[model samples]
Target: MDAAIEQPTVARLITAENREVPVSATLRYRAHDPLAVFVDFPAEAALDGEAVTWTFARSLLDQGLRAPAGHGDVRIWPYGGTRTVLEFHSPHGLALLQFQAAALRRFLQHSYQTVPAGQEDVGAVVERGLSALFDEV
Candidate 1:
């Protein structure tokens, strides 16, 4: 974590489908790789501090989702629950990565809307959600 990288920020936004959701966005990086920017999100909104961190990490490893170049990888960790690690590769390096809290909120909200309610195995849904987001952009 760098002194310049601010703490995670939370915001509410409407998705493409017009659904509103809350999203928390954070910028992170390794001390040695301060130039690389890693963006992280909570697995579930409204989660307890510990559980939120855990799911964030779990979502990465279990989901295998990666961000586009210049956007640092995503990481999830646990404060209480089992930490999940979801990392995205950025060949262009972290300096190119920018944290857009609004975009993240939209991405997440759209992801949930696209997912079938009550259906687990969100990996596929996540992929679809991200693809859709990129397409719209």
Candidate 2:
């Protein structure tokens, strides 16, 4: 049988206006290391080349959020699901997306504790992933 880590999955990045961005995303969970995702975009008008990649780790997301308490115009949880939802506001519009993270959770659980393993532990996984691009969301 093929190794699970060698496999990849798809996820949808949605917007408030119903616009969306489909991403080829993956996760890697290394022992004594942090949790992170590798996102690849297939050439789109809003984004750059087909090789446009946006990668970030779980620690990065955990440290950046102050939600339910964040005094701002938005909130998000990027690493909070097998099928995760990322919702945040942007200068152009409200950007939101739903993604598959089951493989991600398996990878991280191999040696790290990246995503919360509960139906209600979602915090700010999505906002952190999108914050690098979107402004003030």
Best by lDDT: 2
Query: Best candidate, TM-score-wise?
Result: 2
Runs in model 1 deviating more than 4 A are: 1-6, 45-137
For model 2, state the Cα shift of residue 7 in Å: 4.6
What is the per-residue lDDT of model 2 for residues 77-126, given as tens digits with 9 covering 90 to 100?
Answer: 54443454544454646445565545544544542333243422234445
lDDT of candidate 1 at residue 2, scale 0 to 100: 19
Error of 1 at 129 (Å): 29
Q: What is the C-alpha lDDT of each candidate?
A: 0.38, 0.44
Error of 1 at 122 (Å): 36
Question: Residue-wise lDDT of candidate 1 within 47-97, one digit each (tens)?
Answer: 344322312332242233233211145542221232122333335322112
Lowest summed-lDDT stretch of 10 residues in model 2? 62-71
Error (Å) of candidate 1 at residue 11 is: 3.3
Residue 72 in model 1: lDDT: 40
TM per candidate: 0.28, 0.43
